[model samples]
Target: MTITIDGLSIKKKEDFYANIKTELNVPEYFGNNLDALYDILTEHPDRLQIKFLHYDRMCAQLGVPFCQKLLKVLQDADILTIINQH
Candidate 1:
């Protein structure tokens, strides 16, 4: 499955997590945190392709440090294909 997230729409951390939870159809019990995201994506049953548009803008909004952490989690997830478009 493929999911596209527009970085411009993400105003805060919660927006990003909300987008992931909704798009990925994670259970209600899912924790909205980087560790939980990594656990879920790594164990996901289906191959997932996640595309981030305006990645640079997201970094500008969320700060480079946080985006770097988020990117690390996504990169470490074996079952996911992450694409970033600036």
Candidate 2:
């Protein structure tokens, strides 16, 4: 499955988690944090392709440090991921 996240739509950390949770259809018990995100992405049984649109905008909105951390988690995940700045 493919999940696309529009960086422009993410104004805060919560927006990022919410978008991921909703798109991934994670359990209601899912924790809205970076660790939880990594757990879910790594443990997912099916192959997934995650697309990040306007990545620079996302970094600007979430701050480079946080976005770097988030990117680390995503990059470490077993699933496929694509990041786009345009």
- Per-prediction backbone clash count: 0, 0
RMSD of 1: 1.6
Tens-digit lDDT track of model 2 for 1-86: 99999999999999998998899899998998889999998886788888999989999999999988887887788667799998
lDDT per residue as tens, model 1, 1-86: 98988998998888998999999888898897899999889886688888889888888888999988987887788545555666
Error of 2 at 73 (Å): 0.9
lDDT of 1 at 81: 51
Global CA lDDT of candidate 1, please? 0.85
Work out how many backbone clashes candidate 1 has. Answer: 0
Q: Which residue runs does candidate 1 get wrong by more than 4 Å? A: 79-86
Against the true structure, candidate 1 reaches a TM-score of 0.88
